[model samples]
Target: MTIKQHQSPHTIGRNFRLIAGILALAACAKPANATDVFRFEGFGAISRGMGGVATAYDTGLSGMMTNPATLSLMETGSEIQLGFDFVSTDIEVKNKATGEHVSSDSHGNNRHPYFAPQIAYGRQIGSLTLGAGVFAQGGLGTEYGRDSFLSRASGNLDTELGNSSRLLVLNIPLAASYKVSESLTLGAGVDATWQGLNLDLLLGADQVGSLMGAGRVSGSLVPVLGGLPDLRGAHFSLTRNSPIKSGVSAWGHTARVGMTYAFSEDTRVGVAYTAKSRVADMEGRATLTAIDGVAGQIALPGDITIRDFQMPAVLNLGLSQRVSDKLDVAVDVSRVYWSDVMKDIKVGFVSDSGGDINILLPQDYRDQTVLAVGAAYRASDKWTLRGGFRIAQQALRGSTLFAVVPAVPKKHVSLGAGYAFSERASLDFAWSHAFEEQMDNEGTPNTSAPIRVNHSQDNVTLVYSYRF
Candidate 1:
């Protein structure tokens, strides 16, 4: 349905005054992960509660990130949203040839569940709406022990089997919106994002065994290894948990633009586009070790630098309609350009004692599209309920899907509710779950052995808002 905002110009001063009171609170909040890889399904509880069908809806401060034009539909005042996301993820890797699996829990102790915070502010001033928000781009990671099946299959020593990787991106968005006519609004925004990444990974036993077995010399050292009897083995091991670690951080920028149009009292449409972000290279210190049988030991100690890492662009279209007085429905379709940015993961290693080595991890990811539908019901003057579902195509499949980054799940279901304590204050809560998904790889450019990955996730969100 079309949610309208008044633009009489008389309330501009009041809106600014109200915004001043909540600016501090809004500045202290941040966003957490949803159900996407390096990307969240939505920006806030209200958006996620409705399965991210928010492009055409007025969802207060949170929705501004999805479509800044939605800001023009806010009540003639100021508001702030503060919330947290509790996320739990399960990741498992299997050796398809041996029929053994290793769970993330088999590694070192981890928090198991983690928390992500969200905050935002919106204020109406004359014919314009102003807003600011903080949230995280989604990411996943897990740690495994050296003694786990992951290590045994690789035939690596106890110290060489451990693995882990974690990525975090904090986005600070500043946006503005203006009403172009009685039924149309346009908006734009800029996001200054800070990204950090910590990765402890390996080539694993399967890939190493395949490469050495081929003896085709993928790199200069591969052919040399074939001549060494000690290096020719059926199994191999590699790890990243040496004295030096592979961790890096950088700053990036992205832009967003959107528009909303009201076709009638009962129908509205919205469209938005986010440009790809430019990110800097990640450099860190780490040791690369490869062991075959008992006498095969290859140690490459160096500073690892991953270059040309970038975030993909996105396009979203949505429609919202009122089916009846108390019920409203919304649908959204979004496309993510993963293939444009993730053709391969290239790492440059400068040896501490000698030369340089370059490793290319081919991803060949495909663009992904997501479809979402949601329904919201105003059950009573004080209560509102929401339910939604979303399904998306996975970015990686076939042999390119690796253990380190398993973006497998494709379906998500969500439920949410809102309770109003007063005309200006309320609480909102949402829960979502992603069904299990798995991928198997027989062999690819990066691996010659059979490997499998499985994944699932759950998220919970709570937000408190006040309007003045």
Candidate 2:
């Protein structure tokens, strides 16, 4: 393996290490909502069946995130549910112009796959019910080709540009579903969810020259200017730590109220609402280490930066109808305030050199609205069928913050089924496909910077839900 040589270190720095560029890209990875939690439909069954259970979900512990109101409605008794999730995904990136495939695939790359486990348990006593569960909200892991553009052209010498992140949120809830009268049932739950995120950004030799788009330019070669003598063997490296910080989220506390009204002998209508929490305080560290032997070693002090983050509230409405002795159908409609995440991220820092730090997050995307429609049917005495669809706008299609590492969007079709084997237990399975979409940031019309990018994601998930 060989690293190319250049006449000037500035051009070399621009064309080679792109070490600064790496820092810029790394900056974007830690958003106010840095990691994803509470996925669209976490388990395979919910996904394959379209996650339409907002109104008629099983009374298991997993129902807290979807609709706490359902707590008063169903009976799971003393049941314990446990399962694991397996995921596999593929990504294709290209250049918008000339239909060129700029992103490398055969550079010895592997698809994204992971194992996640979760459990839910619930019990009722008198008019009060209690539930608790440990489950991952949602997250993404993407580490592609070691020989890709970002890797080959950069100064990592390690020869790769890799990044991955995982996040999980735990929900502990207590509630009561009271029978106010013969025709009505009223219920409520206090929700407290804990959040956490883990992130990593890596670079190798292959990613060096690619950072500056590797063209050509020349400059004076000397060590006295406080820069590398040339762009070749001088050796340069930078490692940064995202300072350590812990948060007991302010917005994790809220109240939920739900009411179920009996319309007739076989029909019921339910409505539920919950107050939103004030989410803020994203404080973290920024420790940097720099080595430019050609220009001499220079290490920057660690900096502390914080951002104020917020999340929108949610509302759900659902209905359940019994059609025959062996059949029933259910559907639900829900809304989320994605617009709350529409602002650019901002950061304030305290420089060790006695200077105030201030920087604006470059996120300039529109608020989003999502629509979920799903259903489940007991087709026979021993079998149940489910299907559903969901649609939401993409925030990364053409944003100012496009990087070699991309963010995933949610939009797909799902199908699933379940079988009752005996009086004590049952089995279920589900499958889905997210429709592909194209992206290009360079030529989106009227932009000074001309960097082009295009990509899409494909995914598969499997899980198991049990009753005892």
Candidate 3:
């Protein structure tokens, strides 16, 4: 005889709820208006206020997420930090021919005041330090309604062509640092990363025809449907408009290594390198619909996959100097290798009706160089003030497909302050403002209408720390 056991209905329901809650939390982790293209300019309040200059300075446990070597500079005890970033974006798109424009801030339904949380813990043991933390790397997104000029330009003047895109990246890192000598320290970390993407796009008939003529669109469905002469007025769309949905997600891994050396009691230098992420293909399900003057409308539900999308590697170098007993200054320079990963975006759609299609979107992004400088003044034993400025090179070589995801800001000004409430607790706050930038794209073979985008943003960070 054999005996078998099955889970009760109550247990199964409880498990289902738990899984759903986790997925919901992940889906709602949205980020916007990152300063370094789609990547944030800094990690924590102190770094943000100091022009992202954590490479050589001690900014609490948050340094573990950037230059791990700085962790060795913390006091020999246990520390916990909690923080969050609040971001606000202002973006507008215009059709030069139609003289019509749409603002990302005008849509009431558009989610604003985005928030991302950070938490970290570190412990110092003799000459070594260990730490762990969760942080949001950065992301870009925008929303426009059906009545917007973008919808009218797509030839769907009356339909709900909500053009949008949202991308979010999160990291959980385990790091360790060791003090090699009185003036030298080295560190490394391994990061587990998660990325999510959501998109809603509509392409006009002219663009669709150009993609076909250029051989950029292909698949099993091409032979069966491509030959139709009535396709002249056809349009294509991949749409999912809900803000609470992740649409597609993937997991990846990366690593970072860094070192710091003190030249004297008043001067120090640091260097760090972060490897590119190796993420899996983003996979999900969505509706792929086509509208034609002759065929009327055809909708195919399918699974979608975004292939070969990865983050770029970065190198950072920095120096810090103690000019006086109450004044300190720091500077950092970084190189971002964006050209390696931003060549082309390939989208694969496998329709439930039995055919698969592939679409190619070219980005042609260039590498970027960033420089930052900051100063901090100690007004008293309980008060400190900080100010900084940062400048970055333009990352995109062209603006063809950037109208929807405009990461164009190139300069920022920041201010911050820190207060010590007690020996064991403290508070830090920072604010950064990105200057407005505008870019114009010439008419391409796919469409004759020139497009212009204007973008700017503001970011605020607050952190609370407790040491034991």
Q: Highest lDDT among the candidates is held by which one?
A: 3
TM-scores vs. true structure, each candidate: 0.84, 0.66, 0.89
After TM-score superposition, the amount by which residue 120's alpha carbon in candidate 3 deviates from its true location, in angstroms, is: 0.8
- Show where candidate 2 strays beyond 4 Å: 1-38, 42-48, 56-59, 97-113, 145-147, 151-167, 181-183, 199-256, 274-306, 347-357, 394-397, 404-410, 443-468
* lDDT (10s digit) by residue, model 1, range 433-462: 888888888864454457788888777777
> Which lDDT values do the candidates have, in the order given?
0.70, 0.44, 0.77
Clashes of each: 6, 24, 0
Q: In angstroms, how far off is 461's CA in candidate 3? A: 0.9
Model 3 C-alpha RMSD to native: 9.4
lDDT of 1: 0.70
What are the per-model C-alpha RMSD values against the true structure? 6.3, 15.7, 9.4
Compared with the true structure, what per-residue lDDT tens digits does model 2 show for residues 1-468? 012332344543342243234223322221211111124443335533654355444424556555554555545455444544434344444434334344423221122123344566666655555555555444443433434333222232333333333333444555566656545667777766554433323322122223223321112222221243423211111112222222112235556677767676567667766555444454444432222324433333434433554444557676767676544555656565544553543434443544443434344554444555666676765577777776665644365434333444456666777655443334455555555545555621111123443333333323333333
- Candidate 1 minimal-lDDT segment of 10 residues: 235-244
